[model samples]
Target chain A: MESGQHMLRTGRRGTLFEFSMALRDLVTSYHRRGLAWSLAWHDVVSRYRGSILGPFWITISMGLMVLGIGLLYAKLFGISVAEFMPYVAMGIVFFGLMAGTINEGCDTFVQASSMLSQTSLPMFTFIWRTVLRNLINLAHHAVIIVAVIIFFGLWRVMDVLPALGGLLLTIVNLAWIAMLAAIASARFRDIPQFVMSVMQFAIFMTPVFWKPDAFPDRHAFLTLNPFYHMLTTIRAPLLGQEADGLSYIILAIMAVLGWALTFSVFAITRRRIVHFL
Target chain B: MTDVSIKVTDLTLRFPVYGVDAKSLKKNLARVTVGGRLGASTTGATEVTALSHLNLNLRAGDRLGLIGHNGSGKTTLLRALSGAYEPDEGQIEVRGRIAALLDLSLGIDPSATGVDNIRLRGRIAGMSSKEIEDKMDEIAEFSGLGPFLAMPMKTYSAGMQARLAFAVATAVEADVLLMDEWISVGDADFQKLAHRRLLNLVERAGILVLSSHDAGLLRLYCNKVMRLEGGVASEVKDIRRLDELLAAA
Candidate 1:
């Protein structure tokens, strides 16, 4: 009887360890594949579920913004419609993606509080889903990019390959930033408001409407801004211009560091986040 | 030896409830952090102890019932047992996969239909989408939700919602079933069905711990009943154990 009691005690301890490790394992495993296209596609479909036009709403809204800004800003910066159109188009697409992903990620847990507190799933799934959903929105805006180039009659076929490379980099960069922001926003309630304010500031600061050359001597300051590098790399390639290797390197380093920091913070605070909620 | 199913020694949990703002609490915590009492004023204030040096042990086949008043640490103990809250002092060792059902309303997406929500909930429970798909019909039939399964979960009534949620949870087998309260089924028919299902569940589990205010209902289901009085446990001998006195009459 005494030996049996000891064995029972041992089994209970094993169960406790198993329960604790189960959650940890769930999180690491989910992050392995990140977000898949199918899941993101579901989010996009669910977003405009009741709407008649569906995803065309994104296209129409983007087109009007580009037309209004491209016409006004082209004259303000002394650039022709031909040059301004592609810049504004690429700017709107990339910025909209960055803004949407970062802004939405802020409330990643707050929005999913009902789900997380009760369900035993890894928290990272929600973060990746938010990022993927916004990427779908980005895909919708790509139509505007194609349309703008065609309308301006500056459609160089060679720009396609370089544009593809720039888009790939933009996606990688946005993924890292979104992961970092999602983790931070989940921890700090004020992050979404802060991200929105930054986005409002970045729109004017980024060279979306005008050329970097228009800024002349102060152009170096534009290079210093991370958004500036992101904007130029994505937009420059679309405009059939060479992208700076140094800018790509800097952005890549930021992406790597951002991921490391975000994952570490997420891992440490994973258990405690539910308490704050 | 069979191994210890649960061992909690001197476990204590304190939850800080600040009045209005954390500023006052912040100062008190800072003092305590630097090896000082939280001043006389703060010390004189009311502090509720959720759990005080809780010590518990359970072995296989122990279907224990927790009885206490509103603040008598039943829910706190359940959370601690499930690893949701870490004890302030002492360690807990549990030996099986605990399927905790404090709130069945979690993981249901408002926008998703019952089917979609099932997939999401199943995924959360580590079920692949395909696995959820295979069990989807079984869950739907078991829930008895019928045509309403296609509608969004938001449209379902509270009881209907609970049925779906409970059905999905029961689909996954559990070694240790921790129920907050005996789940309330919708109607007489549903209640009968739920009773049958619950009995089936109780047979497979190694240990079952349920917290409820209805001592009579607990006596019906649980083998041992322990009451939490003044932050300490006092086991209540089974009333049926007094059979000799009753039989003499």
Candidate 2:
């Protein structure tokens, strides 16, 4: 018979234990990758179930926006449409990916409250599902990228390797951001709205439509923006331009720091998360 | 086979009630700007102790029935046992595959069809894809919603939805089963079928914890009865003598 002599107290020690338990749960859930993958696929398929176009709707809209904005904005910025079209196309596609992840991440845990309360599955499973779903959306939007590259004759076989590498790095960074946003939004409840507003503001601020040369004097300030680095790392390679070493360094550092901060907070509050829900 | 057991020692759970305005960032920011004392007075941050210093133990073959009034913490205790709520105080060690039926529609997505929901619910219950696939035909047959299974779940009636949920929940065999109440829905014939299925599932489980207000039902199914009042638990030794026990308490 197991003894119940050891009492479980709700304090700092308990939080530390819960943190370790949460990490274990995360690892175990990863081993059960089928759960996350299927759930993510289910979410995407169900959301657009009855529609004829389904998720291709995203591809169509992105294509139209690229055609319209690429033409109008290229002339406005006095750049050749041939050169500017790919830039804006890649910019919008990648920005949609980044901003969509952040926006959806905020509701990750909150939205799964029903399933979370009923089962003993790991909390990280929901986070992974959110990331996977957004990745699926990104895949749908990538068709537009393919079309733009073909239209603009910007496809380079050699650049494909680096672009994929950059995309993998970006996905790694997104996982941590999603985890952080999900946990925070679950606790605060007001965080999803706050995050959505911030993302809306970030799009204009991050040069998704405008070129960096437009503000030659403020180039230094634009470089400091992490979102700019995030966009450039993947966008540059897809446009057949070399991604600067500085952007890679900045993004790698952000990934490490972001995971560290997210892990610490998640460890302390994993147990209390259910209470908030 | 692993021996199934549950041990809960001095388990306490508290829920913090955040009022409507308290959940808003704008309101909280404004409160912080105003002096701490004034903000504290207006803020409604109170804790409701759902379970208080509750201890329980159950070994294999122990069928424990829980009786409690509204707000008496029966559901809270069930949730804690299912690993849904981490206790604020005390320890809970459960050794078994636990199947918790706290709510019928817990994992059923309204947008999905009945067949799809079975897969989703099975996955949520921690079954591997192979297992879900193996059991799909049986679950479909048990639900008896044959043609309706093709339509979205939102199109199903309440009783039909309940039947699907019950079928999916009881499809897998678990060592420890925690159920909030006896589920009886659908028509007379279907209810009888569901009741028989539930009884078979309860018998096959190593341990069962059920919460319900029907004393007669408890007397029939449970060998041990526990009554919860204000987060405290006490055993009722004899079902026949429950009235005397209640009066004494």
Candidate 3:
């Protein structure tokens, strides 16, 4: 974030100064969109090279899990397959995006240790690099979601449009969480595993497979889970179920407050990342 | 104002040598506020003053060589100039764009072919995609990898890898050029070509700061040299007296 006037400086400062530092990093990263994009693309390409199915392998494995789990969970919950299949598929796919992003975000700067130490690239560029990789994986997973919706004859544009809106909000909120996770993991070294265990437990806790509607008595507490709100924002509308206004409100608060907290952490830790590496 | 310049005043950089326990979240959470304090002590950490009160100044057409024993902060100063590391206390003002060959193999992934490594390294050197694409043939030709450019860099010999690294590092255009160590690569033939190319790059840039252990190399490429020891620096000396400087050491 140093200016080209050839001045590079850092010091003790107020909250506004810290916030501006983080904001400046994002702005600088935005200007160098080409470098981050190429790095992310290279990562995706190199990861799957020589594999026959390439990235679709992620979709295929996810597809099979949805099928097996949908059938069994539907029978267990005593719901019809037609109605339950799309819900399960949507839940798994979108939740996978959220969880995968958080998990990978833990390694964002840690994996870029060389680049951080060697180059003058902006710090947030690595944040976007991790986000882009997850988004790419989501594209592959979208294949399963699209096929399930079409096969189940649940293709109403009206419902799909609002669902996409919620999905966008979900993505916005997750970026802050992922960014915070990246910084924390860089410092602590065990945050990635910690995030891993949290996501593992969070899947069941967040209603990815089980229907939130099934447990009427559980409504009050389920709404307390921020991730449940993250899920229903996208999943509910597509199922012809109304996602309560509270869900959007909660997600909105998360996006605002989470970013505020993340920016402060990022500002404090920005220069020290080289030492951590 | 000079087109290319570097200014440093009372620059300091210090960081802890973290122990395994200090890096653990559980251990940190256990001691709570006590952990960070414990980390500053001998059991958990050793604080390293990588550089202290280091002051330097350079302007356009300055060719400065840095000589130091291992761990004497040669790379640290280069990194600070590259903007990868900020000053801990003082200020470093650098005018104009910088191309830092701090490490030749920094972005050179062995799994990538010679062509792909060119693109990756070019981008890191701050080259735009179009620039890399337009210069692709020239870089490959200069590396002399020829048809072997299609194969993974891992398959190439060490000399070949050095050729590829050198070609990409010197390709970028910048007002300030910072190089760590004189790169010696390939057979005698390739070394001559690489030396000429490096001389051209150094001449084109407004300033150059090179760190090397070879005295003859310093005499050949630099007009002045500085010695560093234990995070401190000796006064800068002229190249004509490099022989005396080395003798004095």
Compare the candidates by TM-score and give the number of the best one.
3
Q: Candidate 3, residue A29: CA error in Å?
A: 0.6
In candidate 2, position A219 carries an lDDT of 76
**Clash-forming residue pairs, model 2:** none
| Clashing residue pairs found in predicted model 3 | none
Least accurate 10 contiguous residues by lDDT in model 1 chain A: A1-10
lDDT of 3 by residue, A24-99 (tens): 8788788888888888888888788678988899899999999999999889989999888888898999899889
Expressed as tens digits, the lDDT of each residue in B40-156 for candidate 3 is 453345678988888888888788989888899999888888888866677777887787887767877788888998998888777899999999988988999899999998899
Residues A22-131, candidate 2: write the lDDT tens digits.
Answer: 67768867876778988999999899988999989988888899999999988888889988888888899998988888889988888899777656677888888988
Better of 1 and 3 by lDDT: 3
DockQ of each: 0.20, 0.47, 0.60
Off by over 4 Å in 3: A1-7, A10-19, B33-45
| Candidate 2 chain B: worst-modelled 10 consecutive residues by lDDT | B35-44
Cα deviation in Å at residue A109, candidate 1?
1.8
Question: Model 1: per-residue lDDT, tens digit, A1-277?
Answer: 1111121111123434544443453454354333233456666777787799788898899889999998898888778888787778888888888778778877766776655554334566776777778877877888998787787765763366655666666667776677566666655555677788998888888776656775764367786788877776677766777777777787778778876666666655554455545
RMSD, every candidate, angstroms: 6.8, 3.2, 2.4
lDDT of 2 at A170: 86
Q: Name model 2 segments beyond 4 Å from true.
A: A1-15, A215-218, B39-44, B236-249
Query: Which docking class does model 1 fall in?
Result: incorrect
DockQ for model 3? 0.60
